[model samples]
Target: MRPSSALVLAFAASTLAQDQIPLVDKVKGWFAQATAAVTSAVPAAASSPVASGRAKVAETIQHPLTLENWKETLTVDPSASTPTTQEWLVYITGGNATCFGFCGNATKAWNASLPFLAAKPNAPKFAVIDCDAEPLLCNSWSVGPPSLYYFQIPKPLADQSAPAATVRYQPLNRTSTTVDTFKKLVLDNDFEKVEPYEGYFHPFNGELQQYGLALPLAYVMWGFSKMPSWLPMILISFMSRTFM
Candidate 1:
């Protein structure tokens, strides 16, 4: 007896299903392969000298200075067995949002100096402060962004009462020249050519100064805001007639 068409179709369908992998199984296989690849790559990446070097540079060489850690940058660690005489080189740059057009060249020069600076013996403690992140702190220094400051922190880091020596690096052109000049500044330890930073480092002083300037402007703005919208046009017309 011949098999019915339904039985033949059912047999064909069963064979096709057995020959092809299920979508769920294929997805599982792909995931397993990706996981294995990532796992194998981790060891290779971890062992890479370049990766380790970069990490070390970031941690030790480029110390980020913020309002919170600003004091630590100026002070030495008491836990150390020996007193460190390393001074600080602070690169203050604008934030991405507030960056002026002039920051590009300076930023490039600053970054290029990092590797060279890190390699130098007895290099100054390099730190970067972002103006946008710490506006009050930056303002306290009374210096603009894209500027470099060298601070000769006092010894016995515990002495908070001692004043720190601060100097500003003069503006230079081109990244290569700027890098060379920066290296020389650090190496020669020359402050004669560079101008001294005369700004007060107290945060409260900056805040008070800012408020002093802002209050007058704020009062004027409030007065204008309360005025009638048509008052400005009338005032302009009156002024024009008087001038004519």
Candidate 2:
């Protein structure tokens, strides 16, 4: 008797599954906390700034951002962007709930900084949500930095360079003086150009987007909600087969 092809196929599939792990589940779990982590960061960032009026716009744009106002001030044209009311917020933060008090550093900085950038006259196509005390997330999108997730309306952000082009990964942090790294992501296309938002969640809305997100978040949320069902299933199936 000869071994059946089905048996060999089954054996190969079994091996493949054993060789890998279910990634969709992993992806879901991997960043499950990401949304919560970002949400938690919001209050901390907003607490001080909303209390202070200088979150956006320097007391004087005539000068560059000074050390005194670095944490709570920025210098950009207020007329740069049009004003619109939004509820949902996406945040590009360092890490999780604990990241804010511990691993987090730029959380507060972003909160204070974003408002000003968003309020700018013709302020690009996106609004700056906040800078964080933890600067890691918005600096690079590799390790240690928070994961950048896209949501409803992808905000228009430039790259971390001068004369920024529209990007979907990393959005520009006007407060970051890195220079040459100005990011520009499109509001419609998702991650069509660059790497994950600077480093953290939606740098524009500030998170993976949630039920409450409006403007950028709302837009980002729409995108996520619209994710092709077949794709996720296919991805899940392939991952299941590969990683089992």
Highest TM-score among the candidates is held by which one?
Answer: 1
Which predicted model would earn the best lDDT? 1
Error of 2 at 122 (Å): 2.9
Judge candidate 1 against the unseen true structure and give its global Cα lDDT, from 0 to 1. Answer: 0.57
Candidate 1 worst ten-residue window by lDDT: 199-208
lDDT of 2 at 190: 32
Cα lDDT of model 2 overall?
A: 0.34
Put down candidate 2 lDDT per residue, 143-194, tens digits, no spaces: 1222223333322224412221112434333234221222222233334554
TM-score, cand. 2 vs. native: 0.24
TM-score of every prediction relative to native: 0.51, 0.24
Report the lDDT tens digits of candidate 1 across residue range 174-221.
Answer: 233466666777666554577664543322233434466433433343
